[model samples]
Target chain A: MPATLRDVAERAQVSIRTVSNVMRGYTHVSDRTRTRVLAAVEELDYRPNPAARTLRTGRTGMLALIVPEIDVPYFSALARDVIAAAAELDFRVMIDQTGHDHERERELLTGDDREMLFDGVLFSPLVTQAELLEMNPSTRIPLVLLGEHDFDDRFDHVAIDNVRAAHDAVRHLLERGRTRIAAIGAQPQEQYATPQQRTAGYELALREAGIEPNPGHTRSAAHYSRADGYAAATELLRLDPRPDAILCFSDLLAMGAMRAVFDAGLTVPDDVAIVGIDDIEEGHYSRPTLTSVSLDTAFIAEHAVARIAARIEEPDLPPEQIVAPHALHVRESSGG
Target chain B: MPATLRDVAERAQVSIRTVSNVMRGYTHVSDRTRTRVLAAVEELDYRPNPAARTLRTGRTGMLALIVPEIDVPYFSALARDVIAAAAELDFRVMIDQTGHDHERERELLTGDDREMLFDGVLFSPLVTQAELLEMNPSTRIPLVLLGEHDFDDRFDHVAIDNVRAAHDAVRHLLERGRTRIAAIGAQPQEQYATPQQRTAGYELALREAGIEPNPGHTRSAAHYSRADGYAAATELLRLDPRPDAILCFSDLLAMGAMRAVFDAGLTVPDDVAIVGIDDIEEGHYSRPTLTSVSLDTAFIAEHAVARIAARIEEPDLPPEQIVAPHALHVRESSGG
Candidate 1:
C-alpha cells in the first residue's frame, strides 16, 4: 500500500498532526519538524494524496476536455493530442461528451451538478447559437472553448475557419469544372456556426465563380453522420439537372454520399464528384480516396491545451482566438 | 466563489483550528462547537475539499480505463460505453492509451510512476503473454482486465470469445463455398491471446471443412490497422492461385484488404471475399458493408463497470470471468 500520513509521521518521529500541518504549509510547524517531515516523505516515497493535496492547494491538477461526442474521429484525435500536451505540462485530461444534450453541457460546464473539480475546462458544445447564448456560464472556472463558435471574445477559443474550409471544398469542386454542386450539412433549424459558416462559404465560392447559388442545391442534415449524409444525398440525386458534384461538410458525410452515388449506379467524380472537410483517416482507405479540407486537429489540440494551461495559471489573461490552418486535399473523389 | 472554511468558522463563532478539529472528528471538540460548525456548513453549502475527504475516506470516485489505442474505433466505442456506465454509477472515468508500450503499462499499472489515484483500473493491454507475466503488478490497486488474456483466475477478465468469433467468421466464408481461405492479423513473434486464439479458430474451421491450413496463407500484422492490413493483403494476393477468401482479425484489416483488392482491379466477393471481427460503425458505411463478428461492447462495458464496482465494495470477492456475446454479421463483403 502507498504510504499514508501516519507512515510519514512515524518515519519522522513526529505526531500525525504535525506532519499534516507541515504538508499543508501551516505556519505553526517549526522548521526542524518541517525538514524532518519532508525528509521522511522523500524517504518513504510518500506522494501526497490528491484529495488532501486538492484541499490544501485547491488544485486538482486535472483538466476537463468536454466535447459533443467522444467517439467521433475528429474529436477523438483532438482528445489524444490534448492528452499529450497536458501530460507535457504535468496535467491529466478527463474527456466527456455532451452528446448534444444542453442540460448535460450546462450542468458539467457551469452548474454545481458536477462535483469533480477541474483546473480548467476545454468545452466543445454542439448547441445552436440560441442555446449557446442560453448557457451563459456564471462560474469562475478557467475556460477555453473548442470548435466553431461565433462567440464574442469572452473566452479562449480554438477552431479552424469553417467558412473558408467549406469555401475551399466547394472551390475545389468548381475548379474541377462542376457547375451543379450540392452541399449536404446545413442545419436550417437554427444558427449553428459549423453548418452556417460552411453554407456561407459554399455560396460565396459559387458566386465568385460566376454561378448563381441555388437554394434547392443545399440539403440540411440533422447530424453530420453517414446515415444523414446518405439520406440527404439520396434526395439531392433526384433533383432536376442533378448536381454533378457534392461538397459535404465532413468526410463522414462525403463517405455516405459516395455510397449513395454508387447505390444509384453512378461512379464518383465521373458521375458525381465529392469533397468534404476534416480529413479523417477513413477517407484515406475509402474505395476512392476522399477529397477533403484537412483541419489541423493537432494544432487545435495543442493550442487549446496551452490556452487552458495559461488560463489556469493566470485567469486574468485576455481571451485569445486561435484559428488553425486548413488545407484542401485533392483526391480521387474530387477527380484529382 | 465557493464557501471557505474561514467563512464557516466566522459564521459559527469559532476559530478556524476549532472548525477544522470539528470537521476532522477530533474527540476534544465540544458538542456545541461541532453543532454550530455543522449548522454553518449546511447554511453555506460548503463542500468539504476533496483532499480532506480523501484523507478521511480513501475514495476518489474516479476510475481509469487503460486501452492499447484510444483512436481505434473499437476501443473508442468501448470507452464511450464505459464512460456512460461509469456515469450511471456516479463514478467518472478517465481514459489513457498504452500504445502497446509494456514499460509504460507496467509503470502505470504497477509501479509508483503514476501518481493519480483511481478507485480501480480497467486495463486493455496488447502486450504478449511473456511481457505480461514479466511485469507482475505488485500494487494492491483493484484491477479489471479487458480483452483476451489467458491467465490463472486472479483478476477479473471481460472479453468476447476470440476463438469462437474468429471461427464464426471463417465458417461464414466456408458456407459461401470458398476454399483456400486466407487469414490476416497473426502475431507469430509472441503468444498474444487475441491473435493466437483467432489463428487457432481459423485453422480449426478450415480443418473441420477438410482443408489443411496453409502456413504461407496466414499473415501477421504488426498492428491491426489499415496500413498493416493493406500490406498483409497485398502479400496474400501474390500467392499462386491466390486465396479465394480472406478472414481478417478486425474490421480495419478487412477495410484495408478491400482497398487492396480494388487497387489490384479485383472486385470484392467475386475475386476476394473478406470478413473481420469487431463490427465497428465504419463497417456499416463502408462501400460493401463488411461482414463481421459483432462483439457486444456495451455488454462488456456494463459488466466491467459492475464488476469493478463490486470489487471496490468487497475487495476479497472471487474474480469473475465475463465473456460478452458475439454474433456474425453477414454483409456484402462476404458475398452475402
Candidate 2:
C-alpha cells in the first residue's frame, strides 16, 4: 500500500502543511525541513496521484533532463537531440548534471524536483537506486529512464543493446584475423550496467572462437575517459605478450588508447588496432578514422520524449522498453 | 524610469493581480494570457526589483547557465566548469541551449523567466540584442554575460580577448615562414562579434609582416563547424597560388581543414600548415595534433559565478568587465 501525505508528515516529524509546501516547490521551507520530508518520502515510498495533482495544479509544460555528465560527448549530443524533440511537443527542457553523485541522484529522483516545476523527467542516471525510482513508479511522475539501467518494467525505458554492440566489436576484430584481443572499460567494483554487459559480450565472443580469455588482458577504467583509457592501454602494452587489438567501451577511451599506441612508436592495424562504441563526431575526424558502433541517440531522444509526453496525458499507460539500434562503421583503425 | 506592474497590466489588458501572479511563476495563468503578458513586458521594458522580489518571496537557490549550443565542445566544457564553480558557492545550476536563435535569446533575456524562479542567470547567447538585456539591467536579475559580446558597461561581462587570440594564431603561422596563409571563418553578413574580431586580427598580423592581404585569401564560413571548414578549405586549396598555410577560427574548423589537406593528396606542415583557436581535447589526440589558442574557460566560469553570487548579495554593486587570458599552443599542425 502507498503511504499517505499524513503518514509522510508523521515520519518526517513535520506537519502535513509543511510536507505539502515542500512538495509544491515553495521556497519558504528551510532546507533542513525539506531534506527531512524528502527522506520520509523515499523511506515510505509515498506516491501522489498524477491525475489528481494535474487537476489540482496545472502542468508546467516543462520537462527536466538529468544526466551524469554534460561534458561527455555522448551525453551532450543526446541532450541536444532531446531538447529539440521536446521542443517539437511544445515542451521546454531544463538540463542538470549530477556529476555521478549518488546522494544527489537520490535527492532529485525522490525529492521536490520530481513534480515541483517539471511535468515529467527524462533521466540518465549513473548511480541510481532503482527502488527509489518506484517511490512513485511509472504512474507517479511521468518519468522515462534513459541509457543502461536494468529495467524492471515499472517505468518507460530507452536503451541500446550494449552487450550485442560489444560482441559485434570483438567479433569484427576476430574476423580481421586478430586473435590476441584485449578489452578496456570493465568496472567490476561498481553496480554500473554498461561496463558489466560489455565485459560479458567481450568474453562470450572470445569463448565462441575457442580462445580462453586471459585475465591479464582485461582492464578496468574508473571512468570512460581518454585519460583512463590511456593509462589502461599503457599498462596493456607493457605486458609480456601485448594485446594485438583492443575493444574500448567508449570512443573517448579509444582516443586515449590510440594516443598511447602512437606514443609507444607503433602503427595502427600493423602493431595494434582499436574499436570503440558510441561513434562520436571526434572519431570521424581523428587521424585514422575510428571504427565505432554508432548508437542512435536521435531515436532514443525522440522516443523518450514521446513516451514521457504520453505518460503525462495518460498516467495509466503501461510501461515500455524501447531499444534503439546500433551499427558498426568500418574505418582505418580496424583495417577496413 | 522603469515600467511598473500596473503599466504592464494595462498594456496586456490583464488585471494587476494576474500580472503579479505571472511574475511569481503561478501555473494558473493560461499559456495564451502568459504569452500576452510577457510580450507586453518586453514591449514596455518592464523592470522588476529583484531585491524586493527576494524580500517578498524567499530566494530560490537556483542559477541558470544559458549557451549557444551544448554539443559544441567549448560550450560544454564551459558549462561543466560553471556548474562546478556554482556548486562550490552552495548554488545549483540549470542549463539551456539557444541553438543560435535570435527570438529565443530575446525571450529568455527579458521575459517572465527573468525572476520567475532562478535567483540569477549566467547567459552565453549567440544573437542577443544589447538593448533587451537592458529591459532590466544586470542589477535587475544578477546577470553575468559570457563569451564574445560588445559590452557597454551595463552588465557584468566575462570574455576572452578574441582579437589577441586570433592574432596569436595567425602570427604563429607567419613565424613558420608561411606567407601565403589563407584564413577561414570570416562572417561578413552577421553581427556576430567573434568572427569579425578574428578577421580584424588576421589582417593586422599580415600587414605587420609587410605582406599585402590578398582578397582571395579570405574565406567566409556559415558556421564554425567541421563541414563548413572542410568545404572552405577545399575551395582554398583550388586557388592558382594556393595557400601554403591556413588559419581556422576554431579547432573544429582546423580538424576539417586538416582532412581537406589530406584528401587533396597533401600532408600537414610539409605541404599546408594550419593553426586553430580553442585548444579542445580532440586537438591533443588528433593524428598530427592541432595547434590552437587556448581560452581559459575555468577562469571565465569562476569569475562569472563569483560575480553573479556577489551581485545577488549587493545588487547595487558596480558592474565589471573581466577579460580572461588566452595563450597560443604550438603543436604538430603548425610545424611545431
Candidate 3:
C-alpha cells in the first residue's frame, strides 16, 4: 500500500496537518519542522491526496470538455485538437459526452456534479434559449461555450460565422453555373444553430440570385452522419427535376452524399457539384476530394483553450465573444 | 462570488471542520448538528473545494489516458470507446500525449504533478519492453496496459492476437489464388506489439506455404495512417514483381492502399486483393468497402471497464489478461 500523510506524520513525530502543509508547499512552518516532514515523506514514500487538496485550495488544475458526441469525426478531430492545445498549456482535458440530450444539456450547465468535477468546463450546448437562460445562475465553473448559440449575459463563446460561410459555399456552387442547387442538412425545425444558419444562407443566396427557393431543393436529415447524409442525398437524386449541386452541413455528410450520387451513376462536379462545411481530413482523400469551408480547428482550439484558461485565472473579466474566420477551400469536387 | 465553507460554518454556528465533515458524508456528527449544517449549506449554496477533498482523501475518481496520437482514426476511435466505457462507470478520462516519446513515457510514470491527478491509469505504451519495465514501478496508480508486446506479470493487459489474425488474413489472400502477396506496415523492429506480431504472422504463413519470405514483398512505413499506407502500397506496386495481394496493418492503411491501387489504374480484389485490421467504422463506408480482421472494440470496451472497476475495487487480485478475439471480415476488397 502507498504511504499516507498520517504515516509520514507518525514517522516524523509531527501532526498530519503539518505534513499536509509541508506537502502543499505552505511556508508558515519552521525550517526544522519542514525538513523533518520532508525527510519522513521521502522515507515513507508518501503521496498526497489530490481530491483532499483540491477541496482545500479550490484549484485542481483540471478542465472538462463537454461535446455532443465523440463518435463523429468532426467532433473527434476537434477534440483531438482541443486536447493538444490544452496539453501545450500544461492542462488536461476531461471529456464528457452529452449525446446531444436536452436534459443532459441542462445538466451540464446546472448540475452540481459538473461543478465538482473540474475547475472549469468547455461546453458545446445544443439546448434552446429558454433552457439555457434557466441554467444561468447555477453555473459554478468557468465555462466557454462552443458552437453557435446565444447567451444573454452569462458565458463566453467561441464560434465561426456559419451563415456567412454557408453563403460563401452556395455562391461557390452558383459561380460554377449550377442553378438547380440542393441543400442537405439538419431538419429545418430542429432549432440547432449551424444547420439552421446554413440553410438560411442557402435560401438567402438563391433569393439574391433571382431564383425562387424551391422546397423540393431542400432536404432535411435527422442528424449529421454518413448514413443520414446518404439518405438525404438519395431523396434529392430521386427528385423529378434533380438538383445539379448539393451543399452539405459537414464533410462526412458530403462524403455520403457523393456515395449516393455515384450509386446513381453520377459523377461529382462534372455531373453534380458538392460543397460541405468543416474541412475534415477525410475530405481531402475522397474520390474527387471535397470542396469545404475551412474553420481552422487549430486556431479555434488555441483560442478556446486560452480563453478558458484566462477565465479560470481571472474570473472577474466580463464575458466576451471571439469569432474564428472560415476560408473557402476549392477542390476537385466543386470543379476547381 | 460563491459561498465558502467558512460562511456556511458561521451561519450554522459550528466549526468549519464540522461543516466539511457533514459535506463529506461523515455520519459520526449528531443529527441536530447535521441538520443545522445541512440547512446552512442549502441557504448559502456552498460547494466544497474538490482539490482540498482530494488532498484529504486519496480518491480522485479520475483516470489518465496516455496514447501515441489522437489524430489517427484507430486510436481516436479506441479512445472514444474507452471514454464511453469509463463514463458508464462514472470515471473521468484525463488525456495525455506521449507522441511516442520514450522520455515522456518515463516521465508519465514518475511525474511529480500526476501523483494526485488520478486514481488509476489506462496506458497504451508504444515503447520498448525494457523501457516499459523500467517505468512500471514508479507508477503509483493501478494501471491497465494496452500494447502489442508480450505480456508480463507486473500489470494487467488487454490485447488481441495480432499474429494469428495476420496469418488468417494472409491465408485468406492465398486461398483466393493470389500468389504474389505483399505486406504493408510500420517498422517491425520498433517493438510495437500489434504491428510486429502481424509482420511475424505474415512471414510464418509464407514460410508454411513453402514460399520464401521475400524482403522485396514487404514494405515498411513510418506509421499506420492511410497516407503512409498509400505511399508504401504505391511503392509496392512499382516493384518488378508487383504483388497481386497486399495485407495492411490497419483499416486506415487499407484505405490508403486502395487509393494507391485506384491511382495506379487497378481495381481492388479483382486486380489486387487487399485486407486490413481494426475494421473501424470507416471500413464499412469506404469505397468498395474494406476487407479486414475485425477486433471487437465494443467487447474490449465492456471488458476493460469491468476489469478496471474490479482492479480499483480489489487491487489485491493477481494481474489479469483479457484477450479479445479477432475475426476475418470478408468484404468487397477480399473477393467476398
Candidate 4:
C-alpha cells in the first residue's frame, strides 16, 4: 500500500495534524518541524490526496477549459497552449467541447454535471453575450471568457482584436491592386461573434478605400469549418464578375476556399488572392502556402491563465479585458 | 450558499445518510423515501460536492487521457472521440500531452501530480514497452493502453491492425501500376511503435508481391510531422531513380510530402503517387485530396472507454486486447 499521512506523521514522530500542516505548506509549523516532516514525506513518499485537500480548502487545483470543438485546428491549438500555461500555474485542465451549441454552453455554465470537479473555468463561448448574461447570475464558479464575445465586463476576457486584424487583411489585398475582394465566413446576424467583428473590419477597410461594400461580396458559411467554407466558396465562384480576392474569417475557411479555387481550374492569386485569420500550422505547408493573420496564442494563453488564476484567488476582483496582438503573415496565397 | 446535503435532508425530514444514499443511487431506500429525497434535492438545488463524496467513496468520475501531443490532427481527433465516449459514461476527461518524450511519459505514469485526481488513465505512450515495464510496477492506478504498443497483458489495449493496414496501403499502390514505391516515416529502432509496425507491413506486402524491399527506398523522418515529412521527401526526390510512389505514416506527413512534390514542379499521381495513414479532415480539402488508411476512431474510442471502465470496476481482471477496424480511402492523391 502507498504511504499515508499517518505513516508520514509516525515517521516524523509528530502529530498527523502537524504533518498535514507541513504538506499544505502552512507556515505555522516551525522550520525544524517542517524540515523533519519534509524528510519524512520524502522517505515515505506520502503524497497528499487532492480530494481530501479540496474538501478542506475548496480548491481542486484544476480548471475546465471549454471550447467549441477539439478537432477544430484553432481550438486544438488554443487548448494546447492553455494546457501548457495552466501547467505552469500548477493546475490541471479538464477539456469540455460544447459543439458550439447554445444549450450545451448553458449546461456547462449552470448544470451540476462538472461544477464539483473544477475550481474555475476558461470558456470560449459560441453563444451571444445576452444568452451568457441569462446564465451569469447563477454561475457560482469563477470563469474567464476567451474569444470575441464579452459579457459587458461581467467576466475577464482575452482575445485578439479581430476587427482590426480583419481590416488589415482586407487592406493588404486592396494595396495589392485587387479591388473586387469578397469576404467569406461572415455571420453578420450574430452580433459580436467572430464573423460579425471580422466582416465589420472587411467593410471598414473597403469603405476607407472608397469601394462600396457590396452585399453580394459578403458570403456566409453555414458554420466555421473547411467543408462549409468549401461550399460557400463554390457558391461565390458561380457569381458573375468573380472576386479578385477573398478574405476568410479563419485559416480553415481560406484553405477550403483555395481548394475550391483549385477545383474550379483556377490558380490562387492569379484568380483569387486569399487570406485568412488564425495562422494554423497546416497553412504553412499548404500547396501555395497561406497568408494569414496570426494571433499570438502563447501570449493569449499566458494572460488567460494569469487572469483566471487571479479571478480564482480573488473572486470579487473587477473584470479585466486584454486584447492580444496579431500579425499579418503575407505568403504565396495572397500573392506576396 | 449552494444547498448542501444537510439542507436537503432537513427539507425532506429525512436523515442526512438517507439523502446521501439517494444521491449515490443506492437502492436500499424505499421508493417513496427516494422520491421525497429527490424532490427535496431538486427544490433546494442541492449538489453533492464531488470532492466530499470522493473522500468517502474514492471515485472521482474522472479519467486522465495522456497523448503525445494534442495539437496533432490524429491525437486531437482521437481526443474528441475519447471525450465524447467518456461523457456518455458520466466521466470527465483530463488531457495530458507528453510531447512524445520518454521522460514526460514516465512522469505521467509514476508522478504524483495527477495520480490522486483520476480514477483511471488511458495512456498512449511514446516510450517502448521495455521502458514502460520499468515504470509498470510502480503504477497502482488503473491504466489502459492506447495505440500500437502493448505491455504484455499488464493492461488493456485498443488499436487498429497497424501492420495489416500498412500492408494494404502498399499493396494498393503496387496494384495501381506503380512500382518503386518509397516508404516515409519509418522508425526502425523503436520496435512495436506505429512507424515500425507500419514499415513491417510495407515490407510484408512487398515480399508477398515477389519484390525485395530495397533499403534505399525506405526513408525515415525524425518525427511524424509535416515539416519532417517535407524534409524527408525532399531528400528522397534527389535520389537517382526517384520513387514512383510514396507511402507516409500519417496524413500530415503525406500532405507535407505532396507540398514538396509540388514545390519540385511535379504533379501528384502523375510524377508521384502518395498515400498516408490517418484520414484527418484536412486531407479532404487538400489540392489533390489525400488517399489514406482511415482508422475507425469512434470504434476504437468506444472500446477503449468501455475497457477502461471495466478495468476501473475490476482492477484485477485479465487484460483484454481489441483491434478496431480500418479502411483504405483511395482519393486523388493516389490516382483513384
Candidate 5:
C-alpha cells in the first residue's frame, strides 16, 4: 500500500494539517517541522491523495483544452502555446477531442468526468450557438472559448477580429492589382464566426472596390484540409473565366489551392495570385512563400490561459472578451 | 450550490446507496430504481462528484500523457490518437509538457500532484539512459513509457525499432545511387531517443555500405522544428561539394531541408534526394512529396490506451512492452 498523509503525520509526530502544509511547500511551516515531515516522507515514501485535496479545495491545479483536432497545425500550435503557458503557471492541461461531433461537444461540456478532473476548460467549439448556450449554469465549469465562436455575454472568450483580418489580406491582394479575386476554402456558415467574418470581409472588399461579388466565384468545402482545399480550388478553376486571384481561409488550404493551380498548368503570382490566413510555418518554406494573415497564436494562447486561470481564481470577476490583433505577412505567393 | 447525491436520492424515493448505483450506472440496480433515480437526476440536474468516486474506487478514471512539446507534429498527432483512444474508453487525458526538462521528468515520477489525478501515466521520457535507470520504482505508479527510454523491467513500454527504420531509410537513399547522404535534425542526448537511434542507424548504414562517414555531414538541432532543419540543410548545402542526398530525422524537417535545397537553386531527386521519418500529413503534400518512414500512430495509441487501462483494472498483471512495426513510405523525394 502507498503511504498516506495519515501515515506521514504519524511518522513525523505532527498533525495531518501540518504535514499537508509541509507537503504543499508552505513557507509558514517551521524549519524543524518541515525537516521532520521531509525525513518522514523519505522514510515512508508518502504519496498524498489528490482526490481528497481536490474535494476539499475545489481545484485540481489543472485545465482542460477541447479542440476539434490536434492533428490540425493551427489548433495544435494553439494548444502548444496553452500547454507552455500552463506549465509556467504550474498547471497541467487535460486534452479532449470533440471530433466536431455535436454529441461529443456536449459531452465535453457537461460530462461527469470533468467535474473533478479539471479546474477549468478552454473550448474551441464546432457546435451551433444554441447548443453551446444550452449548458446549465449550475453544471457549467469555468470555461474560456477559443477560436472563431461568436462571443456571448455569458462566458469569457478570446478571439481575433476575423473580419478586419480578412479584409486586410484581401486588401493586400487588391493593392497588388489582382482584381478578379475568388474566395476558396470552407463554407462560412458551418463555423460560428471566423470563417463567416472572413467571407463577409471578402464580399465587403469586392463591393468597396466597385466589383460586384459573384456567387459563382465563392468556393467552400466540408472542412479546412489540404484535400478539401485542392478539390475546392479545382472546382473554382473550372469556371469559364477563372478568377485571377484567390483568397483561402488558411495556409494549409492555400498550399493545396496552389497545388491545384499548378496541376491546372498555371504559375503562382504571375498567372494567379493567392492569399491565405493563419500564416503557419510551412507557408514560409512552400515553393512560393505563402502570403497570409498572421495572428499571434502565442498571444491568443496566453490570453485564453490567463483569462481561464483568472476566472478559476476569481469566479466573481466579470467575464472578459479578449481580441488580439492580426498582421499580414507579405511573402512571394502574394507577389511580394 | 450543486445538487448532492443524497438530495437526488431523497427526491427519487430511494436510499443513498441506490442513488450511488444509479450514478455509477451499476448493472445490479433494478430497472425501476434506475429509472426513478435518473428522473430525479434530470429534475435536479444532479452531477456526480468524480473526486469522491475516485477516492472510493481507487481509480481516477483519467489517463495522462507527458510529451516534450505539442507544436511538434509527431507529438501532436500522437496526442490526438491517444485522446481518440481514451475517449472510446470513456477516459480523459491530462497532458504535461516537460520541454525535455530533466527536473520536470524527475518530478513527474515523484510528484504527488500526479497521485490520484490519473489512473495511469503515458510517459515519453526525453532523459538519458543513466537518468532513466536511476528512477525509483515505487515512484512510477502505473507508468507506461512511450518512445525509447531505458525501460526498467517493472514498467510497461511502447516503441518503434528506430535503428531498423533509420537503416531502411538510409539504405533506400544508398540504393538510389546517392552515396554522399547528409543526415540532419539531431536533438540533445538527454532530450529524445528517436533522433539518437536514427543517427546511430545512419552511421551503421554508412559502415554497411563501405562508405566512410563524414562527421561534418551530420548536423543536430536543439529542437525538432522545421526552422532547425532549414538551418542545418543550408549549412549542409554550403559544403565544398554539397551532399547528393539528405536524410532527415522527421518529415517536417525534411520539408524544410527540401525548401533549403530549392533555395540553393537545386532540384529534388534531380539534383538532390531526401528521406525522412514520421510520415506526417504535411509530408504527403510537400511539392515533390517526402519519402519517409511511417509508423501507425493510431495503432500505437490504441494499444497504449488498452495497456494502461489493463494496468489500472488489473494491477496484479505484470508490465509488458509493445513494439509496433514501421514501414518505409516511398514517395518522390527519395527518387522512388
Candidate 6:
C-alpha cells in the first residue's frame, strides 16, 4: 500500500496538522519542521491523493477549457497553448467541445457535469453575451472567457483586439495596390460575433482609405469554415467587377478563398491578393503561403491561465479584461 | 443551497438507500420507486456531486487521453473523435500531452497524479513497448492503448493496421504507373514505431511489384512534421535517380513534400506523385489536394471507448486487440 499523510507525519515526529501545513505549502510552518516533513515525505513516498486534497481545499488544480470545437485548427492551436501554460502553473486541463451549439453551451454552463470535476473553467462561448449574463450568477466555478465575447466587465476575458486586427489586415491589403478589396466570413445577424467585428473593421479600413464600403463586397457565411469561405468567394468572383483582393476572417477561410481563386483560373496576388486572420501552421506550407493577422496564442494562453489562477485564488476579485496583442504577417499570398 | 441526497429521499418518500439505488441506475429498484425518486430529483434539481460519487464508487466517470502531442493535426483529430465518443457514453475526457517526451510518458505511467482524477486512461505512448511493460503493473487505472504501440496481448488497443494500410497506399502508387517510388518519414532507430512499420509495408509492396527496393530512395525524418518532411524531400530530390513518386508516413509530411516539389519547380502528379497516411482535414484544401491512407477515426474511437468501458467493468477480462478499418482516399495529388 502507498504511504499516507499520517505515515509521513509519524515518520517526521510531527503532528498530522503540521505535516499537512507543510505539504500544502503553508508559510506558517517553521523551516526546520518543513524540511523534516519533506524528508519524511520523500522517504515514505507519500503523495497526497488529489481527490482528498480537493475535498479539503476545494481546489482540484484542474482547469476546464470549454471551446466551440477542438478539430478546428484555431481552437486546437489555442488548446495546445492553454495546456502548456496550465502545465507551467502546475495545473492540468480538461477539454470540452460544444460544437458551436448554443444548447450545448447552455448545458455546459447549467449542468452539474463539469462543476464537481474541474476547479475552474476557461470558456470561449458561442452563446450570446445576453445568454451568458442570464446564466452568470449561478456559475459555481471561476471562469475566464476567451476569443470574441462581450462579457469583459462581468467575467475575466482574454482575447485579441479582433476589430483592430481585422482593420490591420484590410489596411495591409489596401497598401498592396489593391482597391477592389472584398471581405469574406461576415455574420450580419450576430452583432458581437467575430465575423461581425471583422466586417466592421473591414468597413472602417475601406472608409479610411477613401474607398466607399460596398455592401455587395461583404459576403456572410453561416460559420468561419473553409467550405463557407469557398462558397462566399465563388459568389464574389461572379460579381460584375471581381474583387482585386480579399481579406478573410480566418486562415481556414483564407485558404478556401485561395483555392476558389485558383479554381476560377486566377492566380493569388497577381490577380486577387489574399490575407487572413489566425496564423494557423498550415498557412506556412500553403501554395502561395498565407499572410495573416497573427494572434499571439502563447501570450493569450499565459494571460488566460494567470487570470483563471488569480480568480481561483481570490473569488471575489474584480474581473479584468485583457486584449492580447496581434500582428499582421505579410507573406507570399499578400505580395510581401 | 443545492438539494442533498437526504432531502431528495425525503421528498420521494423513500429510504435514502432506495434513492441512491435509483440514482446509481441499479436494476433491482421497483419501477414505481424509481419513478418517484426521479420525479423528486427533477423537482429538487438534485444533481449528484460527481466527486462525492467518485469517492464512494471509485469511478470518476472521467477518462484521460494521454497523447504524444495535442496540437498535431492527427492527434487533435483523433482527440475530437474520442471526446465525441466519450460524451455519448456520459463520460468527460481530460487531455494529457506528453510532448513525445520519454520522461513525461514515464511520469504519467508511474505518478499518482491522474489516478485519483481519472477512472481510466487511453494512452498513446511515445515510449517503447518494453518501457510500457515495466510500468504497466504499477498503473492504478484501467488503460487502453491507442495509435502505434505493441501492447496488444497485455492491453486493450485500438488502431489501424499500419502495415497493411501502408502497403495499400504503396500499391495505389505503383498501379498508377509510377516506377521510381520513394518512401519518407522512416524512423529507423525505433524498430516497432509507426514509421518503421509503414516502411516495411512500403518495401513489401515494392518487392511484390517486382521492383528492387532502393535504400537510397528511402528518407528518414527525426519526426513527422512539415519542416522535417521538406528537409527530407529536399535530400531525396538530390538523388542520382530522383524518385518520381513519394509516399509519406503522414499527411503533414506529404503536405511538406508537395511544397518542396513546387520549390524545385516541379508539378504534383505530372512530375512527382505524392500520397500520405492519416487524411487530415488540411489535405482536402491543400493545393493539388492530397491522396492518403485514411484511418476510420470514428470507428477507432468507438472501439477504444467500448474496450475501456469493458476493462473498467470487468477488470480481470483478457485484453482484446482491435484493428480498425482504413481506406485509401485517392485525390488530385496522386493523379487519381
Indicate which candidate wins on lDDT.
4
Residue range B160-266, candidate 6, lDDT tens digits: 88889889998998999998999998875774478777888899999999998998888988778999889888888888688999999999999999999999998
Q: Compared with the true structure, what per-residue lDDT tens digits does model 4 show for residues B1-336? A: 677778998999998767765664545679999999999988986656887566556678999999988999999999999999999998889998988677777877876535768888998877777777776443347778888744577657898889999999999999998888899998746654788888889999999998899999888876789998898899889988989999999998998899999998988989999999999999998978999999988988889999999977866678888988999999999998
Kindly list the per-residue Cα lDDT of model 3 for residues A1-336, writing each as its tens digit.
677777888999998666755675544678999999989988986757555455445567778888887767777777888888987887778877788677877766665444656667888878766666666433346778887745545678888878888899998899899999999885756657777888888888888899888888888876787887888999999887889999998887888898888888998888889999998877776677789999877777888899999987876568888888899999989998
The sequence of per-residue lDDT tens digits that candidate 5 reaches over residues B1-336 is 667888898999988767765664445678998899999988997756776576556677789888888778898899999998998898888887788677988888666556557788888877755676576453445777887734656678888888888899889989989999999876655346678788888989989999988999999977777888889999999997889999998887888889998998999988889998899888777788789999888888988999998877766578787887899988889877
Stretches of model 4 off by over 4 angstroms after superposition: A1-48, A188-192, B1-3, B6-48, B188-192
Docking class of predicted structure 2? incorrect
The reply for model 3, stretches above 4 Å from the true place, is A1-49, A149-153, B1-49, B52-57, B136-139, B147-149
Lowest lDDT 10-residue stretch of candidate 1 chain B: B131-140
lDDT tens digits by residue: candidate 2, B71-142: 989988998889889878967676777887777777776553234456788988665445545454422457
lDDT by residue for model 1 (A1-336), tens: 668878998999998666655654445567998899999988997756676566545578888888877887877888888877887897877778777776897778654324345778888866654565555433336778888758778667998888888888888788788999999999866657788888999999999999999999999988788888999999999998999999998888888899999998999989999898889989999978999999898898889988988877776688799999999889899887
CA error at residue B117 for candidate 1, angstroms: 2.3
Instruction: Please tell me what DockQ candidate 5 reaches.
Output: 0.39
Residue A97 Cα positional deviation in candidate 6, in Å, after optimal superposition = 0.5
lDDT for position A248 in model 1 = 93
Order of the predicted models by DockQ, top scorer first = 5, 4, 3, 1, 6, 2
- Report lDDT (Cα) of residue A242, candidate 6: 90
Writing each residue's lDDT as its tens digit, candidate 3 over B258-284 gives: 989989999898889999998876766
Q: In candidate 1, which residue ranges exceed 4 Å CA deviation?
A: A1-48, A113-116, A128-138, B1-48, B111-116, B128-138
Tens-digit lDDT string for candidate 2 (A300-331): 99999999999878766888999999999989
User: Model 4 residue A24 lDDT?
Assistant: 42
- TM-score for each candidate, following the candidate numbering: 0.87, 0.79, 0.87, 0.87, 0.87, 0.87
TM-score of chain B of each: 0.86, 0.80, 0.84, 0.86, 0.84, 0.85
lDDT of 5 by residue, A268-292 (tens): 9887898999998888888888999
Better candidate number, 5 or 6, judged by lDDT? 6
**Model 1 chain A weakest 10-residue run by lDDT:** A131-140
Per-residue lDDT of B5 in model 5? 85
